[model samples]
Target: MFLLSFPSLIPLLRAGLDLDCAESWIEEKGRPLRDFLSEYSKAAVEQGKLRESDIDNALRNQYMTLMRLGYFDNIPRYASLNETDICTDEHRSLAHDGARQGIVLLKNDGNLLPLDPEKILAVAVHGPHARAPEKVMDGDYTGPPCRYVTPRQGISKHVKISHRANTTIYLGGINLHIEREGNDREDLLLPKNQTEEILHFAKASQNPIILVILSGGGIDVSFAHKHPKIGAILWAGYPGGEGGNAIADVIFGRYNPGGRLPLTWFKNKYIQQIPMTSMEFRPVPEKGYPGRTYKFYDGPEVLYPFGYGLSYTKFHYETSTDGTSVTLPATGGHCKGLSYKPSVATTPSCQAVDVAGHACTETVSFNISVINGGGRGGAHVVLVYTAPPPEVAQAPIKQVAAFRRVFVPATSTATVPFTLNVCKAFGIVERTAYTVVPSGVSKVLVENGDSSSSVSFPVKIDFSV
Candidate 1:
């Protein structure tokens, strides 16, 4: 999991950070890395900063992990990693499946997707990403893929999307040039030229055009969402090697896009008002600061909210709440006058609790039924969010307490059973330690696709302890 990107220790390593692994520096730096590490470690140990045992443990852990990965074997895994071993049929299939799961159908007004080949004859493809997999198909770390399927190549085979007249597919997103390891995006809007180009094409065109954004982060695509000509939109993220094939499959109805957006798509002005370096999570209206994430941000309406996605088929969600409230246990010395006589927390003031303890077993359960009304069978993600009482300052507007994915057959229903531990699910944090505060007005919201259901319930914690 760890890749040594740097040969020098000065930048990354500080006093307490022990380097368990380092790249070969002799070839570039004219000295072995161990020489510098030995001197530094000796000084650290003598200064009572680091213990010899700590150094041994760190190296031991690193070696154990490497050994488990077959690093010390006579025939290590990489030794046999030939071209044939790298991108096999299985690997390609996995890459395709991953891309299918990640590609989000952002908008599908008037059911404008699932292009039927029999209905359509030809199409227009624009933007640089449509032709090749130069940047959008790859991210931070990558190797030459066995094959690359551009959007043009993928969509070219099955051209028909809808009966709603002439179609144009615009692929304009961004690459690593926008955001990466050391880089921060200056804005969320697609470049002015790209927006102008989309608008220009849209103006001359008819009713239904498709726009596909292929970036890792959120982009402000309010124009296309509201534009009458733009009928459908997709966020293909940095779809990997098999990206084109997956996209074509989704468009042609060979595969249904069941993936949901992992982030909120804020407007261009949101990033302009908020600094890139801002780390505040909660919103403070008095200071004119909107929050961040689905949990906290109170900024202007996001172009697309978190967990937003449109499916080719409609899904119905029905929740059967087990109980409105769950009772926590009192245990240890902390249990004094709590409801159950035992404590949910192992420490004073209920900072943390033992989940396996007697008090934490009982949870608020919800049985969610996902019924696929459409003829097509596809995957659906069930997101459960819990909102603490407004009185709790640190508590988010809503938090994703739990979630599950279920594949309901066509015209069938699948029940997703989700539970939340009374103590942990409702806790609020202030700096280092968390404080448990149960609210009678707490609400749990269960959402799937475009439909959402909610139930108001209270989590009873033995806070008296």
Candidate 2:
């Protein structure tokens, strides 16, 4: 039998009873509101007081509001509304797109990544969540689909994987909701025996093991070093539906992983002195904190640095200019001397350099080149700047004046030209009793990534003032 079926009852309960108590009573009194709306809507329609479409809209709005308030799971209702098609193409696309976007490039020393699937033998896939499905959209705990792709399944498409096999590839990690929501992880270890399993495989296996972490954030895997046999590790976060396929593609050298880390992975939780625990915002001044990331951080070297990613190839960087001194052709446009020993571009004039002279009136060109010696194609970053000693500018340990990314093929090289502007160059911050001013220096530098670490070359220009 229908009871007090009133739309306004929700507001009355909200105002009078605690949310928790109200939810319990509402669940116990469910049919009342539904019955009232159905009957009232029918009467209104019959009397022409309200249109049928209006009633439908009101009901849809009420349902959605309840869904948002954690009062219901409306998936079944939505599923039926869209033409009884149990499975939609959008669900499949979401899975694929999610997986592809979650691939993270952590490290690539000696270009050991994008595994050669053809040469692979037996692979070992181990991890609690490796085959587990993510939590349902409504936060229900559902086991993995029977037809799921674990690391073994995904990689097997390209190469043979083993339970007692040759190479071992471990894919496992905690899900995102664990650390982000359901009360942040108490420890930084890879969840659910994943760390122990990886270590066990690395020790027992004779062939190289690839450890892939399927997570949304970093985890402390100090044990990683103990498993030197684990040749490579890739952080493949909770990739959407296509994640399994993408993981396989990367392993088989089908896709070159070019993604860089958006966060630093520490050795463990203890090492992450300032963990992101508090959701509240705290304002820190610019230049307020130093050595936070790879550069200025006073802590131990991280497992991986931010902006760190690997390719299947290697690049050798050489600059024609020095930190204390830099050179560019007087004519301006592109500089010629900015180059590498063995580069991708043939014509020196294809690139440019710039130089400045006294009274801050100079312009010139700079050229840079790079060579790929690895067996695969990848990209290289060329950074240029005019820098002083760290004590001199109190500037960023290294100031990047200009930069470029040059793509190179295996066993090939390329050259790029950059022009330097005088007004941009000869400015120095002179500190008086209180303020800093733009003064002149006798020299400027053009170098690679770090100014202090790179060799210095003289740029011919007059800066005496």
Candidate 3:
């Protein structure tokens, strides 16, 4: 991961050094946040709240505070910090930087994105949740203060002008912090008022209205169900201080805004509707279960599903060799007994190799090509999966093995071979059979969505040999 920090470094140095992208890459990738931090840092020095040497010291303190927030559990990159108190600049930057990456672009039919601000006439922003939380609203913001740019504030940078003017940008979604019960929202839908706001703007806007939602979870946009006039819908999430600005940049073609949801944004569903606790659990519908995610949920549904996002540009993918052979890596023996590396065993041709003892070869390789088939540049990820044999006493249906991301320039193509071995393929089955079966061929496939069309290859296994 650290190696990703200095992306400009030579490939060989990274390969030899086994270097990872430094955590600072978060700072590097987030230019707006960094600039905010730099300016805020300077402000602190002038205010006598801190000194030149205090920058690092303050970061350490904020790191600790972040860790204790429990938000770090979901976000591990922030775990490395040891500081407890933080400077306002650093704290605000951290929030903005983290939220920026979490933004997801749900759909962009034919790449109708990266809107041109100069061309746009108006933008209308609304949402019960658009403004800061009530706590933030009522509290005394004594520190450097919680500076934030709302979707409305952010969008203003690119567009000409309009609050009640010509064009419009609708910004609002579910208020997560607002409590309906002792527990927060279990149902992922736009709050009642927020949904109205979306529809209200859709009707009110004279020019093409851009819909943007600042939410922590997914919401039902079915109201916009095939609505013709509404131009774009952006799942901005809880983007922090610079969120408004970053979103504005993305809207008006300043940034490509290549982001996808990390979680499922259901049209109408909740966690209980899905099976997480019991594999043996049967599907129940009358209990308001509409199936969960791309796994069991049938098609033509979902406002947006996981891995769903769009870019200003479009992308296409191609594959070369459909066959594969796997090779095992050197790993501690104890881990081997716990988890199996299927990359070393499963091949496109349905072959399985044993990954138990020493490093072995059952190398499976797939040549994948990506093309920027649209107007601009975009990134694509090749997700590889292993299917279980036709009959398994108790086995997962499929397991993700290998994934690769590539940036394709407009009207250009790039091809890279993805290799997967044993370890990458399977998870540990505690107190279960550890033996390898050699007779049947294992199915390997490459796809995007869980059910997205993919090319598959078969392999031959030789466990006894």
Which one is best on lDDT?
Answer: 1
RMSD to native, candidate 3 = 15.0
Model 2 misplaced stretches (Cα beyond 4 Å): 1-115, 135-153, 181-187, 269-291, 321-367, 380-389, 392-406, 416-465
What lDDT does the true structure give each of the candidates? Answer: 0.71, 0.52, 0.55
Query: In model 2, what is the error at residue 73, expressed in angstroms?
Result: 30
- Which candidate has the top score in TM-score? 1
Question: Which candidate model has the greater TM-score, 2 or 3?
Answer: 3
lDDT winner between candidates 1 and 2:
1
lDDT per residue for candidate 2 within 196-284, as digits (tens), equals 77778878878667777776667876677445677777777655445677788776777666555656676674334554542212212
Residues 89-185, model 1: lDDT tens digits:
9999999898998889988989889877777676777876887557668877677777888988888778743324477788888898887754678
Q: Estimate the TM-score of every prediction.
A: 0.80, 0.53, 0.62
Error of 3 at 123 (Å): 2.0
Q: Please, what are the lDDT tens digits per residue for candidate 3 over residues 1-465? A: 322322222332323332222222234345523233443446656776555555655566667777788765866556655434443567766766555555566655444566666565655555554454433222122233265576556666666454776656666665435522222565656667767666677787675566777655567776664676566777776565567766776777665665666666665644545544444222344554444444345334566666666666666556766654433333343222223334455333323333354354456666867667677776666666676454432344455667776667788998868766554453323224553333345677665433334577765433332
From the highest TM-score down, the ranking of the candidates is 1, 3, 2
What's the lDDT for residue 455 in model 1?
Answer: 42
Residue 41's lDDT within candidate 1 is 60
Question: In model 3, how large is the Cα lDDT of residue 462?
Answer: 32
